[model samples]
Target: MKPAHSEFPAPPAQLDHDNCRGVASILSRVGDKWSVLVIMMLFNGPKRFNEIKRLIGSISQRMLTLTLRGLERDGLVTRTVFPTIPPRVDYELTDLGRGLSKPVIALGTWAMDHMEQIEAARAHFDQRNDTA
Candidate 1:
């Protein structure tokens, strides 16, 4: 018979120093609040710079510009410039970016679903701590 824990999946491969550093670096970039918000904004389709800023509401123009440039540099987004009396620029997700969107959206959905429960838990913890 198989061992009791045999049904469980094996753990992931161990990361060497270099691999760990690389993973950490990438996570620091992609895991930031701004980056996640930007990715979600582009998940549906392309949007103009102003449109994205408007959609996200509180993001400053400079921060939005920096976020777009960083995403473009990382190959998760593309910027297109249209020739017109007034120049137009659009940002769209690359295939690699779309791959990231599925997990990000699921995470966002999970957070939204559990927010009430999470808040209640925090309140309970605080109340208990205060009484102690």
Candidate 2:
């Protein structure tokens, strides 16, 4: 007994160029700022929840929870829980997540190399668009 909305519209099994475009749209979900930071932190090794919180500084508890959940759902990150007097949790990048590191690192490098130029372009664009 499945509800209509509950079912997912998966990309068709037939190999097609459009399938690649559809997957790109899906990847955008995990490519946001917080998700990228979470993956970068795990690029070194596995880390505990609090450790990741400290590493990412400014992220609120709620946001960290949400971002981790999304990444986990996408199989980009894995969460482990240990049974003990006090429950413990840890997160790490899966192999797919690790695969994204190179591209993310390249983006970081590009940002560093072009930041000044980008800022200048933004200033010019803003000035050109200003009504006043």
- Top candidate on lDDT is 1
lDDT of 1: 0.90
lDDT (Cα atoms) of all candidates against the true structure: 0.90, 0.86
**lDDT tens string, model 1, 1-132?**
956798667865887899889988878878888888899999999999988999889999999999999999999999999998699999999999999888888888888999999999999999999999
Q: Where does model 2 exceed 4 Å of error?
A: 1-21
* Candidate 2 C-alpha lDDT tens digits along 5-65: 7465765679678888887876786678888788878999899988989999989999999
Q: List the candidates' TM-scores in order.
A: 0.86, 0.76
Could you tell me how far off, in angstroms, the CA of residue 10 lies in candidate 2 after the best superposition?
Answer: 25
